[model samples]
Target: MISKQYDTIIVGAGLVGLATAYQLLKRRPSERVLVLEKEASVATHQSGHNSGVIHSGIYYKPGSLKAKNCIQGYMELIRFADEYDIAYELCGKLIVAISEEEVPALNNIYNRGIENDLKGLKLLTKDEIHDYEPHAAGIAAIHVPQTGIVDYPGMANKLAELICQSGAEIAFSEAVLGINEATSTTNVETEKHSYSATHVVTCAGLQSDRVASLTDRGNDLRIIPFRGEYYQLKPDREHLVRNLIYPVPDPKFPFLGVHFTRMINGGVEAGPNAVLAFKREGYRFSNVNVNDMVDTFSWPGFWKVVGKYGKTGMGEIYRSLSKAAFTRALQKLMPEIQESDLVSGGAGVRAQACDRDGNLIDDFNIVRKGNVVHVRNAPSPAATSALSIGQYITDQLFVN
Candidate 1:
């Protein structure tokens, strides 16, 4: 096998990994930073398949890593997009309380926005909501004028460009098999090569827990893949949404319900429901890998998830198989929307970490083993918070 040595080795070439590499290279230009990706090209997983929405850090609790990084990442991402000329828009999003019961939740979200120091956030009256999205059905709404979408794959590509220009190397289609953490360095063995780094920070995403296990620190948690299936509005129905439109999310479940997003490409997408995935990268029902399923089934964490979320899990499965049921849920926010208005858009698998006791890990959790740091849980806003998260990871590596 090809042998190499570097100052840092980042596994996974998704947005987070690329961002980590970019930030590390930016700090110590002479340091050799190597990034490895399993895909033939970059961003074939969550980073590329995401809704592409630039989060405003609204949903996250104040003082959390998600909240802090998202706000900072937005600013950094804006600068990066401007620098690279990536097509993006700061066109706002509307979060609507569709019923009387949702008013308090709407207020809570508004307050969270305030705590996160968001500017231009407006809690609109029922009548005032019409001026923003005429077709939206709601009793009250919160206008987040900072929420936007961009090309994340493009962002990863741009970061890769920056890394290359800084003399760091990226090796794709190389899957990490083992990581031996030593007192002073980490030895990483991939499918095609072996490398040693003084320090290693992984953004493994889908295989995060597994990567951490290789470092001997992921014993307490396991990654459970949750597939988020999307649907795109037909061309004729593109005018239905001017920007991002959302419903007040279900509090019990970590999912933000079906919503509409106008992508940078000038088309609209809707309905990304969270369902349990059969495989780590299963985007569809037919794409099952027996080994993945068996591994998940064998894990105690997966059982814990089943015990806790059995009812919600069944509901998600029901909606996944029934088109009419899914449409009925979608109609809660957009009553005018018909089943025919949507077609299958791409799906993204979320690498959600569950504790041994079966509790879902909601925030960004990083645990270190020896000289290696493993990113255990980094879901939705990870791409949005890429740069800031990158900076944070870099800080953690050198600072601590």
Candidate 2:
């Protein structure tokens, strides 16, 4: 039996979900909204575990969803931060090419930035690179002055606060187990209670596929979990990285290569090697779930991905296991960085979506079935693109 009814019910209280709720209330203040989260507080997973970089829409392909949302969201985020007094900085960053082979890729990124209409993008020569980051070494680089860091968790929390202030309810520790879409309303069954809503939006992140499956069992996509591990520079060596120093990412893979970041809170963080995680939310190698592992191995796409990227996967696993290997990857950008200058940092799991044909979905995907909308894949720029994505989702929801 449904004990309560709301106009809309949102699953997951991460940045995207919270932003969705915020937008919904902002536009339709009279509509009843409820946000359901499985955790005690907001941003308990991917949203909190990120490196906190505010992407400048430089690396994404022109005309893609990631590029569109990121560029629009970048401006909206700055405006939101200023309005909310949330702490953030536009500290700028560099995408550096350590070898001559990387320059072509570097030029490609610059061209994409131009197509994306990103301003003040300066291409730097080997000598000019020092003008920005003195200790950094690169044959060529793109100085992206718009890239910076922010306190994402803080922003998420404030959104939640404003959501509640608007008379909406955010129920914590309520995990949605099933969904039944009827003629006019959908019944969402949770562990503790049953609720009904005219519409349901799920931004479940790690469990997005599972949540979507509750309504549409034949969904073709599956989320492949990849754990990104970080290492913070020792306090004494933090000065080596003035801002963000990134590598020319491997175009074939979605994971950005390990890099250095000057965090908004202070200090510096290096690395973030992406390796396959046995558990959906697993942070450590030893943190495994048999059920999650089975779900992963049972998928045909899993084996296909492994077969194609076996060599690159092995190298990332090697870096995850060996501190020396991780340091060497970072040393390509800053040669002075040694293993001793680093300390173990946090880890984040990315819910990368893969299809049965083994193609990794590279863009943000939002699909609507019946009255339910599922955010199937939202990674990296998702956080930075939260507000704009929220607006987009809101527009879709009320389009009729």
Candidate 3:
């Protein structure tokens, strides 16, 4: 097997991993870094498949890692984009409460946004909701001026370019097989090569838990894959959404419900209902892996999650099978939208972390054991918060 040595070895070449390498090279220009990706190129999964929304830290709770990284990374991302000439837009977004039942949750989100130090937040009345999104129906709304969209794939590619220019090596299609930690160096064995590094950071998204378990045996968390299915509006129907229109998310669930997003490139995207996936990277109902299913079913937390969210899970499955049900969910936000207005779009699988106690971790869970750091759970806003998360990881490696 080919053997190599580096100052740091980072697994997974997604946005976060690439950003980590970028940050590392920026800080210590002389340090040799190597990034390994299972995919042929960067941003093949979560980082590339997301809605591309630059979250304004409005939905996350104040003082949480998600909030801190998203807010800080938002600024850094804009700066990076500006410096790199990547295409992006600050079109803003609206979170609407379609009924009185959702009003309290909307109010709470507004308060959280304020506590998170977001500026230019406006709680709008029913009439004012039309002022931002003319076709959107709601009892109340919160206009988040900072939320926008960007080309994440493009950004990921740019980071890879910058990292390579700075002398870091990125090897594609190298799947990690094992990680062995010695007294001073960590040896990482991939499918084709064995390498050694002083420190290893695993940013493996869907396969994070499995990768982390290679070194840390007592990992208490299991990654439960949830496939978020989306639909794109017909070309003629894109006008229904001005920028982005969201629903007041269910506080019980980590997912923000089905909504509409105006893509930074073009067209409008609707949907992304959270449904349990049979495969870790499964993007469709027919995509199933027996091993992945076995891993999920074998976990005790999976059963508890199913027991608690059975009804919601069934609803999501129903929507996945029936397009009319999905349309109805979107109609709550835009009354004029019809079933025919939407065409099939893409899907992304979120790697959500679940503990033995049956809790779906809501924060960015980064665990450090010995000289290795594992990003156990980083879903939405991760792409937006890539730079800050990278900087944070860099700090962890150097400081503590």
State, as a TM-score between 0 and 1, how close model 2 is to the true structure: 0.99
Off by over 4 Å in 2: none
Preferred candidate (TM-score higher): 1 or 2: 2
- Sort the predicted structures by lDDT, highest score first: 3, 2, 1
- Give TM-scores for every candidate, taking all chains together and pairing residue i with residue i: 0.97, 0.99, 0.99
lDDT (CA) for every model shown? 0.87, 0.93, 0.93
Clashes of 3: 0
- Model 2 C-alpha lDDT per residue in residues 156-227, reported as the tens digit of each score: 999999999999999999999999999999999999999999999999999999999999889899999999
Task: Name the lDDT value of residue 281 in candidate 2.
Answer: 89
Q: Count of backbone clashes for each model?
A: 0, 0, 0
- C-alpha RMSD for every candidate: 1.4, 0.8, 0.9
- Residue pairs with backbone overlap in model 2: none
